[model samples]
Target: MTPQNPNLARELSLLLALATLWGSSYTFIKIGVETIPPVTLIAARTLIAGAILLAVLRHRQVRLPSDRQTWRRFFLQACLNSVIPFTLIAWAEQSVDAGLAVILNSATPIFTFLLTVLITRHEQATTRKLFGVIAGLAGICLVIGVEAIGGLGESLMAQLAIIAATICYAGAAIFGKNFRGLDPAVPAAGSLISGAVILLPVSLVVDRPWELSPSAASILALLALSAFSTALAFAIYFRLVQTLGSVGTTSQAYLRVPIGVAIGIVFLGERLSSTAWIGLACVIAGVAAMTMPRRSEYRAAQSAGNR
Candidate 1:
């Protein structure tokens, strides 16, 4: 398929990196929280990520959302994109597997596409995009296997919480679309700060972090989560969106699972059932079909124009 833009290949590469890096986050969070309380981990993650990004943006002479209105927009974006989803996923991880959580989180694109159309008159869904969405979910079903139903079992509440995480992701996608015109660093910094604002208070109240002493290793891991996984990764992502458009860049989630699963296996010693592998294939196929450019068609049109 022909890419929509000349720089699409480069954007895809960046998106791939973004996906792989983010995939590692599930493992990092899991390990870090072992030594630190989950709420406190999230709160620390947000603040550190926010501070580093804001400082770097300032160093680069990049101006962010200066006005109250823009800050508010960023605030809402953070709530949907980072704060809410991060909190839900962190909380849900206590009960769910990393692979299961990410597989479910992969629903973001489908929800993003639908939310885009419902929210914006211009971002209407096309047949290809719709099919991709349907096939993608079907793929997830295959990878996880029907056995997941039995595992999810009577713990319907936990399953619902994971689904709720995806819903938050969908909301974030819609909110992120509005960031098209802003500087990538602007929203990156702003949303993180917003996340910190909300998470800190809640974490302090619930975790009562003063009562629990976290180890140095967990603190280091949390720093990596903020620096490599959260802040830097987001910069690469928003930059890709600028080059490839949000729809194109968002497709990166397809690649995230394999990398995430592999990381889980190697670092966390995760073992997925055979049914889950098949499900993974389905998810990958659907996302690939949706994201790949129709190069043959673009070439034919180019030839016709030459004639």
Candidate 2:
């Protein structure tokens, strides 16, 4: 659908909301992994978020798919969306700074665009999208400041893990389109349930979470992450996959960098460098370029000629 469609506006707004939800997740994750082992932390995240989504589904009288094939797809989505990426990010955060992680992980749209053009051909590969990718990357580099790059070469292994997780996210955005026929919450809930099932056993075996003593702050952070970041965010995410297509939906990756910085400004009394202000503008422009419907560009060109 074109950006002129009213629904597209709502979807774009949802995209911004999704960015805000996920932007705060790094802080929550950093706090959560302090005492809780990565496996245990992510296992609980999926479990809690899945349960919440399931409850919402039930409230809406929606049921998850019962077929084996659908469940298999859900399992794969779980791996790409949560089971692997979640654990990787949580583990990496132990050694990697959140700034570097955000900058590296924000490359999801670029990967999504490449994968679409090369493998899936799921969406149109327009020049606008290509520009969006370049601009978004530049914006992220500026938003985090040059100082953040100092950690890049230091935590080589952990930095690599974040990139791996970013790739998984790219795959998830494309694959998630497969669930278009189902209610957004159905796949969201199903995937999280699948993730919990996969990770719980591993957490039990590896972390022995029963013996661990987590701080109250960490526990609260886990709850916030599970509820806001995972449960609610996945519901919105799946909807955007249906409405916005993969590349457009993944533009939220660019939005999250600036949103995270804004969160810091409001809550932590942080000030943005001039570069960061410029980065915020670039991010807005990049997201616009990525999401602006082709028809809008045509209308603008026609109007300019008439003028």
Candidate 3:
């Protein structure tokens, strides 16, 4: 379907809501990690989200795939989308500033574009998509500023980890196409369960949560992150992928930058420079250019004028 199709409005709304949910997650992670270990934090996040989704599945009567192959694909998707990326981002946030981390993670669309073009070949890399990717990256750089790069040498590993998480996210977006026939909520719940199962033993061995005491604030943050960000956010995400395609769904990365910055400013008392404001403008423009459908009539009109 074309981007300008009637469904695009609903998709864009869902995209914005998903962005807001995920954009706030960096702040939640930053708070949660101050006391909670990364592995334990991730385990808790996925398990809690998984449990809630499980309840929803039963309530809605959504049947999960009993077939081993589908379950196996679900596990791989869990690792790529949730288990690895979530853990990496949590670990990386232990050192990296939340704003900077958000900026780095915004590279997801670029990775998504490349993977779609090279590996999955699920979506054609149209000129609009290519330009949107470049413009989105430029907007992120402008939003965050070059000064943020000065600290990269100090947090090189952490920064790289976040970048790696973005790569995994890109891969997950493409790989998720395998579940097209399944209910979105089914995979969303199943993947979280898979991630939790994978991380549970590791967290137990490494963090030993029995010995660790977290603040009430940290506990609340973890709950919010799991409920809103992971559970609800991902359900919407998979639905978007089925409808909008990978490029369109991954385009939420661009929206996340601005939304993340705004959350920081409003809640964290962080400041945005004038350049950052300009960058937000660029992000809006880029998203419009990329996602807005090219009408056949408009293309024909332009062709006739050129001829």
Arrange candidates, best TM-score first. Answer: 3, 2, 1
Report the C-alpha lDDT of model 3 over 3-23, residue by residue, as the tens digit: 223455677899889989999
lDDT of 2 by residue, 1-307 (tens): 2222235577789999999999989878888898999999999999999999999999999988899999999999999999999999999989875666788889999899999999998788888889999898899888888877666789788889999999999999999988977999999999999999999999999999889999998999999999999999999999888877889989999999988767666654555667998898889889988887777655764565566
**Would you list the clashing residue pairs of candidate 2?**
none
Candidate 3 stretches with Cα past 4 Å from truth are 1-6, 296-307
Runs off by more than 4 Å, candidate 2: 1-6, 264-271, 296-307
- RMSD to native for every prediction? 3.8, 4.3, 4.6
Judging by lDDT against the true structure, name the best candidate.
2
Give the RMSD in angstroms, all C-alphas superposed, for model 1.
3.8
Q: What TM-score does structure 2 among the candidates reach?
A: 0.93
Task: Assess every candidate by TM-score.
Answer: 0.86, 0.93, 0.93
Q: In model 3, which range of ten residues has the least summed lDDT?
A: 1-10
TM-score of 1: 0.86
lDDT of 3: 0.86
CA lDDT of each candidate? 0.73, 0.88, 0.86
